[model samples]
Target: MPEIVYAYLDVNYWHPWKIFGSISSVKQLELCLPSSKEYPVGTVFHNLVYLMLCTCETEWLNLLLCLLRDSPKLKFLRFEQYHPIRPSEERPCWSEPSSVPECVVSSLETLEWVKYEGGEEEKEAVAFILRNARCLKKATISAASTDPVKKLEMLKELSFLSRCSGTCHLTFD
Candidate 1:
């Protein structure tokens, strides 16, 4: 089979079949499983490099962390929450885990997030990236708020990009 360069799956149709094996040479995979329970382990995508997950739930996030622990070739990572609508009266939490898989935070060269809600967990994740990902060349964070102060803070924290051999960019709208 040809090396799978990309794979996108909806959450409802996700199944633990040999699809991963069919793409043993895959270099990039993007999953949007809205209801995925667990990611299969030992399913080697030897040539896999880039990974993106969208509209993922908390459990899926856990599975992703586990996958990154094993996938060393991965270089680029992007995550975006897929909430259908902003809460009318309640604000939800957007915290990430205290510890992220070292393989991901340390190896990624580029990281991007859209609609990131600021929280302690999220802060820790960004901190991990800033501290461990020495090779990170660029980072982009987009949020729905247009507040200048909030935007400045994100930029300041991510200003560590200056230390990198490349540049980091942040945007808010």
Candidate 2:
């Protein structure tokens, strides 16, 4: 009946048996995906402005990176986890002749992390995003806990990580 400008995809719910449309109009998306053995291929996002991704594991973040690669028009990215996982997940390791995704190299403008626990994998992901997202304007990282010492540590660590954007602004909360 009307154009859709926003979409939410949560795996914890029932979805239409068959759904398809001119989602070309969608500019924002909120996605909550659970950890699993299988990962979906291909996506419908195009010309998006913002995306908030919630997952239970760091492994799922690769999917987000790939999605962002495809959604070259995306501007802002947000990360949230439904559960705090062990700091065991490894950093992104490409197989061969690896290079940063074009979206990270050019399109991304801002990134924010909510409930960031400063896990190794999380830190690596943040560092990777910062180092590659050449056009990034700002990055905000909020820890799960409000402990002043821990927050300060995380802030120092993330702020110190080199970013490709000369004007990137980093803040912690």
Q: State which candidate has the highest lDDT.
A: 2
Error of 1 at 81 (Å): 2.8
| Predicted structure 2, TM vs. truth | 0.79
Computed on alpha carbons, the lDDT of every model, listed in order, comes to 0.60, 0.72
Considering every candidate listed, which one attains the maximal TM-score?
2
What TM-scores do the predictions have? 0.69, 0.79
Q: In model 2, which regions exceed 4 Å deviation?
A: 1-3, 13-25, 35-40, 82-97
Tens-place lDDT per residue, model 2, 55-163, is: 5644466667656765768888998876555567654432221667667787889899999878676888888888888899999988997899998888888888998
Per-residue lDDT of 12-46 in model 1, one digit per residue for the tens? 55465446567667788776654435455677655
